[model samples]
Each structure stands twice: as C-alpha cells, then as structure tokens.
Target: MRITRALGAALLTLGLAAAPAAADTPSPGPSDGKAPASAGTSFRTAAEIEQGQRATAGGSAGDYLYWSFPADTGQRPTVRATVKLPGTHAAETWRIDVYDGLRRRQSCQYGAQTRTAAAGASSVELACVLRTVRAWAEPWANDPLPGTYYIRLTAVGLPVLDRGLPVSAEVRVDAEDIGGPAAVDGSLAEPLVPGIATEDLADDDSRAVLFGLEPDDGWSSGWWSDRWVWTAAGGVLAALAGVAGYALTRGPGRPSRVPPGA
Candidate 1:
C-alpha cells in the first residue's frame, strides 16, 4: 500500500511538472487569412510616405487616402486611411477616391456626409483604424491587376489652409488570400494553450491554413498539436506508476498461516 501510494505521488508530481511547459509555449497570433505579399508592402498612408505638393481649395480635411476591395471578388483587400480638415472644418468638403492600378480611373470613393471636423476631431474611421481618421477600402473588386494602385483626395469645394488645403495621400496594401502573401507559412506548429477544439482550429482559413492546404494524400489530414500527444504520454506514465506501486506494497493474496500438519 505504501509503495503504491508513493508511486502515485511521484506520477502526479511529474504530470504537474509537465503542465508548466505546456503553459509556457506560446500560441499563434490572430490572422486575417492571406500571407505577407511584400514584407508589409501592400498598405500606405499620406503621412506614411512623400506628401503630395499639389494644393487646391475646398480641400476637405487634412489630405489622406485609403483603399480596399472596391468590389468583392471573393477576397477583398483592406486599407487604412485618415483625413484632417483645416481649422474648424465645414460639411461635405473631403473626398477620397480609389483608382485602379491599370486603368488609373476612379474605382471607389469614400466621402464625408457630415461637416468638416475640428483640427483635432476632423477624422472618421472605416476598418483597420490606426491613428488619424482611419478607414478601409478595396480596389481589388474594381478588377485591379496585381500592381501598385493610386489613391487621390479632393478638397476642391470645402475649406482650405493658409496655403490651400495641405492635402496628402498615403496608401498601402492590406491582407490577401491565404496563398497570396509569401511570408506566412500557414501552420499552427505553435500550440494554443490548454486545448483548442479540432473544430475551431480546422475552421480557420487564414494564411496559416496554407500549412495544410495541399491534399495530404496518404498522410494525415488536418492540424494536430503535438502537445496533446505529450499529455497522453504523461497519462500512460502515471498509470504504469500506479500499477507498479500496487504490486510492490501488496502481500500474498491469501495471507497464508502456519500449516497444522507441521
């Protein structure tokens, strides 16, 4: 009995020891499918690069431009944009237009329906908002060929700065489909702590999904973390230890007494 108890204790301790390692392993970060196309090349903003010198009156807010899938082609590209107006902005003065990379024509437009914003408050957001009046757009749907595109802003009708609307346009490419970006390997080699259900892991079609995109053929399909296998191994070790302990502490089953004939 004592031996059995000792063995059980040892196994429980080992199992407890292994658990910390499992917890320490980092999991994967959140992804929106698609891979890195150009070391973060796809997206840009007015302040992100050279400022456009062209100035005009009625410049909406501080000149900024963003792009996204103008039309949904199964996969929609998203961009981050922000706009700033001079002084106290008036209404309906700012306009951001997305142009096709090949055609160089208007693909889509994001216009402010309300009045201009204050110096500090003259910004609106769409999606992927990061500082400024960030918003998102898609030029891919406008049948944009794979190449650099253009974003233009017009403040021609609203207000202007002391030196015309100091309008600027910044642009960049956002996430692509799982196979588009090359940087992403599409693998969950990194474990999600505790235990993520197979269903949840399987449903993700992000860039990481490319890890198993190709048919497995004879090989196993779907993703399976090695962590679970390790845990099962630990369970087996514990069970063996318990059995060994029971055998060591157990006496003869009958508890034999002295023979009367002797």
Candidate 2:
C-alpha cells in the first residue's frame, strides 16, 4: 500500500512539472487568423554595443554593435526606420506600437501616413520623419522590470495588410539608460549596407566579432548567411590544401612498385 502511495505521489510530481513546461512552450503559429507571418518588412540591427569603453562619441567610430534591445528589462530605444511598402497594397494605413520585454503595452503612434501607390504601383515608401517619436514607454516607468521589448506594427482594419511582416531595428541602450528613455544624443551605428535584405545584412559571428557584441541567446542578429553550406565549403578547401601539401613535399619520383608475384 505504501509503495503504491509513493508511486502515486511520484507520478503526481512528474505531472506537475510537465504542466508548466507544456504551458511555457511557445506556439510557433499566430494566436488567431487575425495576424499571419509578415513577409514584406524586415528587422535590422541598427546600433549595438556589447561592452563599454571610452571612444570618441558619435560619427560612426564607436557605434554600438548590431542587436535588438530591451532584452530582459525595460523598453527598447527607438531609432530611424524607413520602410518600402510592397507595390501590391494600394493605399494602406498603419499603426506601430513598441512594447517592453514583458509584452505590456507601451508607447504607440497612429496615423504615420503612407503615401499612396503612384498610380502604376500599389505600394509606397514611408519613413518616420518625426524628430524622435516616442515608441516605447520610459524604461523605468514600466511596471514589470523592462527588458527586450518587441516592436509590433499593425494596419488597422486590414488584418492582412501588414501584420506579421517583421519591420524594425535594434537600438541598444546602455547601463545608464536602463529603465529610461534614450538620450537625444544617443545614436545608432551606420547600416552595414545601403539596401535592406539578408544579403545586405551582417553575419552573426562576423557582426559580433567586428562590433564587439554579446546578445542574449536565441536573439536573431537580423543578419542572414548560409552557415552549413559555407562550413562544408571551408572543409573541402582544407582537404584540397592538405592533398596539395602532401604532393608538394613527397618529391618527384617514378613511384616505387613491388615486383610482380614476388
């Protein structure tokens, strides 16, 4: 009876542990049909600094590394965002909201006007012209300790208009700026390239090694490169080099051979 009771208790404990995990596991799909994965817009890492050191402020010399901010506390700092709408949606209205790490509603702006598609096309270019529009709540003012927050953009009335289309840049906030809005003087590093796309973005290791950044695990660097394919290529090159080195060091000789049927 005691053994059965103990077994029951063990099973109960295991079930309890599994319950939280099942709840915690994130669902890969959207919550509802309201929003699907966005395919048009993209995310970029504007400015990121993994560690601090004294460098002449501004002018691209000591810019932050590439990464998104509000990683685990407070709100993310906002920077310039320029979006090119697809030449499909005729004239669309959109709203963008920035939230803290905890998914709480933060600062939001409505009616960032987007120009209509120029007659022949159905999309337009929209840029944030405001001199530092407030996108996130003051990092400190957040009820939940602010952390890496998400920038969500939605097109009102047009659920399919621009939802899930990822668009935004990561503006890293320094230790001092934690729980506070970024300073006007705070700035983002220059882009890796002029146009937006994976081709124009930086590689994860390359960006970190170059800019000196260390972001939280699982954070997308917003840079894309085919890692596995490149790795295989590198291995092939190394093998070829080894073969060449052996041939060169072996010295020319009429290759030694054993006597037939010795």
Candidate 3:
C-alpha cells in the first residue's frame, strides 16, 4: 500500500510541475500588435510609419486616413487597411492609394492596391505594394525613390452632400528591410524629397518610424526570437528540482514493513 501511494504521488507531482513553461513565456512589446494611434489622425504631410493595429477617428463620410513612412533602398513596403462599416448601406465605398514624397501615386501590382465594397455584409480590405524603392532613378519618371511615402484611405462612393459616416479603420504597414544602403560616400540614398503637408507635426508623434541600425545584423528573421529553448530549459529545471526535493524527503530508509495480516 505504501509503495502504491508513493508511486501515485510521484506521478502527480510531475503533472503539477508541467505548468511553468506557460508562465515563463514573455509578454508582447510595443511593436508586436500594439494598438494604432487615433484614426483620421494621419495626414498627407504629417503621415508617419504605423505598425500593428489602430482604430480610425470617427467623422463624416469621405474622410481620408493617411499614413507615411521613409523607405530605404532595397526595402519592400506593404500597406494594408481594414475598414469596418457602420451599417449595411450600398451607397458607401472605400479606396486606398499609395503615393511618394512628391505626392505621385505609386503603382500596385497585385489585387490589394484598389478595392471597393459595401458596408452591410462585410468590411473592405485594401493593400498597396510599393515594390523595391530604387536608390537612383529618373527625375521625370514616377518611379518609387528611397524617401518618404504616403498611404491615403478615402471613402469613395459616399454621397457628395451627406454628412460623412463614422467608419472605423485599421491600418498595418510592414517594411521588410532586405539589405543595406551600400554607402556611396557623399551621395544621398536619394534626394530628400519634401512632402506637401501643411500641418505642424509635433516632434514626439508616434506615427512615423525611422529605421535605425540593425540589432542582429546576421539574424535573418529577428534577434532573440528563439524562445522555445529557454522555455524547455526552465520546465526541465523545475521538474528536476521538484523530484530532488521529493527524494530528499523520502531519505535512504528501510522499506516500509508489511503489516501483519489477519
């Protein structure tokens, strides 16, 4: 009876010790799916790079949601926006456009660039792919240059006279840095093309993200992303400690004496 009880207790203790792996996992940071800034807040001249998710500010129909970011040579940027319709109105429509620092609309290849849908049945999704921004390009052509770019979201089909409908929007931009600027001594990556914004944007606004030096230059995906090893190590250490404590409590004593049976 003593042997059976001890074996059962050992198994139960191991089961109880399996919970630390989940506890050791770290929490997410600001860049990982952090909420977006107030909607309708982004502007043409004041647009900034926005990551994760954020809701659009409410206002009349036909309002535009703008976002801007600086692009480096060899970097491919993707901008996508999801707008939730307030109600099922066939008259409502939405569109997304990508523009450069000079306000020239960049061309999109895939089906994500321009889209239109009604509000009642489902939300509308739009994506603009500004393929690799070239470092050196013609001044006449509207090719994408390594500089500031804009994302404009507009409600396309709303009535011209009706007060704008309050539609919520979510914007996500992922700028994958493929390679370096290949420093050219004194030459600029591309001319610092100025934007056409009029509003006086604050210095501390969270809209724009300026990519700095790489943390793990050799890392392909991201630095310190390998979390499984640490999780497994922690769980193993915890289980071994629990087992050692149990063994110490049992000591090297003689086996339990069998009770004299009737």
Candidate 4:
C-alpha cells in the first residue's frame, strides 16, 4: 500500500509538469490551402491549394468555389468544408463534390456529400473520404487514383430572400498515407503499371508473367462459351420439331411417319 501511494504521487507530479509544457508549445494553424489567383472558375483555375491547408474565401450565395490538392499513391485523400450561411442561405442547401485529376466526379467511399445547416443554424460542415485509392486500379473501375484531386462547393436552391447576401466557407484537403498494399509485406517493390490486373501476375508461366494469358486459352470459362452446351440445346430442339411433324401428319396414331408420304 505504501509503494502504491508513492507511485501515484510520482504520476501526479509528471502530469502536472507535462500540462504546462504542452500549453507552452505552439499549435499549428490551418494555412496549407492557399489560392494562387484572386479568382478562378474550375479546378485548373483554383486560387489556393496545398495539403492540409484550410483556405477560406467569401462570395455571394450563387458563387461557386473550387480547389485542388495532390493525392499521392497509397494515400487516402480527405476533404472537408465548412460553410457559414448567411441569413438568406438559412434555407438554402449546399453540396461538396470531389473530382479526380482529370475533373471526373469521384465516388464518395466514406463521407457526407451535403451539409445543410438547421432552419435556425448559421453554419454546416461537409466531410469526404476516398478510401485507399489504388495506384494501379483496373481500367474498368473508376477508383480514385494518386493524382491531383478537386473539390467543388456550391449553394443550391437559393431562396428568393438570399440572392444578394454574401457567404463564406473554409476548405481543407489531406492525403494521409496509411501504408501500401498488404501483399507488399513492407518490402521494397517494383514499379506499378496502371490498368494491369494483379491477378494476371500471380502465375509463373511466361504467358501469365508477360501477356497475362496463354495464346490458346480463353478467359471466359462460363457455359455461354461452351460449344458442346449449345450443340446439345440445338439437338433437343430438332428432336422436338421432328416429333411435332410426325404427330401432325400421322393424324391420331395412324402410321408413325415411315418417310415417303407417311
């Protein structure tokens, strides 16, 4: 009991000292997103941009804001925006959309698309997350890739009373690196080729390693590609047609069609 009491005193003393030290340390400010231009229309024309920087700007209710940020390979990109609605926008709704490097709309894997303030509230925040955007995603899949991404904010369904009022918002983008693919095993790896299916590289044959398939083999293994399956179906249909012809010509079990003129 005496030792436990002494240990508790030491822990209390350490916590008190750490509190002051932490308070003395300066915290970082949100200054990463900086617009390069005074005004712009699209992602390419976004004014300020930098990772983790919460750039802010003011505009009228109908104004639109765009921003861009870089998302590196093996990183999960995140975007967040807070809109301070004016008296006119209290009833108006707002949306935050994410786009890829080529200005394509990105799917929201893990975040809210719209953030609307309550009827009496004056502000709302929207958050978005792109889960594990593959660096070498399949060509058919429009998964987010490692490249410049864009965020677009707009106020929709503006009320008649809020057309002329001003509005403001803050936007911040981040690409947090969580780690690479699980198959990597934390080791050095070769470069990745986009659109190359990983399954094609699992085999050791030269065909699978080089071209991802054998020259004489087909990829489709389903019944739709089996010639024998279709042949049997055709034979069944032919038998049914022959029986129907025999039934109609024989007329009530007369002579079961013995060829020439029944």
TM-score of each: 0.30, 0.28, 0.54, 0.54
Tens digits of per-residue lDDT, candidate 1, 1-262, equal 6566666776776777667545532222223344322111123321111111121222323433332222211123344444544444344344444444343553333333223333445554322311111112243433333223344544435444323444333333343322112111123222111211233355575333211211111111112233444556677777777777666676548575888997
Candidate 2's displacement at residue 144, Å, is: 7.9
On the 0 to 100 scale, the lDDT of residue 68 in model 1 is 28
Whole-model lDDT, model 2:
0.33
Write candidate 4's Cα lDDT for 1-262 as tens digits: 4335544555565565445434432222344334443324565466546665667778777777887665544557788888777653456778888887556698777877786666656788888887765545555767666555667888778677777677788887766544313012121122221222233334653331212211111211111212333345456546555666666665764744477765
Ranking by lDDT: 4, 3, 1, 2
Q: Rank the candidates by TM-score, best first.
A: 4, 3, 1, 2
lDDT of 2 by residue, 23-133 (tens): 432222211222211211223443222312111111111112222233322223332223344434434454444443344555423234333333224333333211121
Off by over 4 Å in 1: 1-75, 106-120, 126-142, 160-172, 178-262
Show pairs that collide, candidate 4.
Answer: 32-53, 33-53, 34-48, 34-49, 35-47, 35-48, 36-47
lDDT of 1 at 152: 51
Error (Å) of candidate 2 at residue 77 is: 1.2
Give each model's whole-structure lDDT.
Answer: 0.35, 0.33, 0.56, 0.57
lDDT of 3 at 111: 49
Residue 83, model 3, lDDT: 76
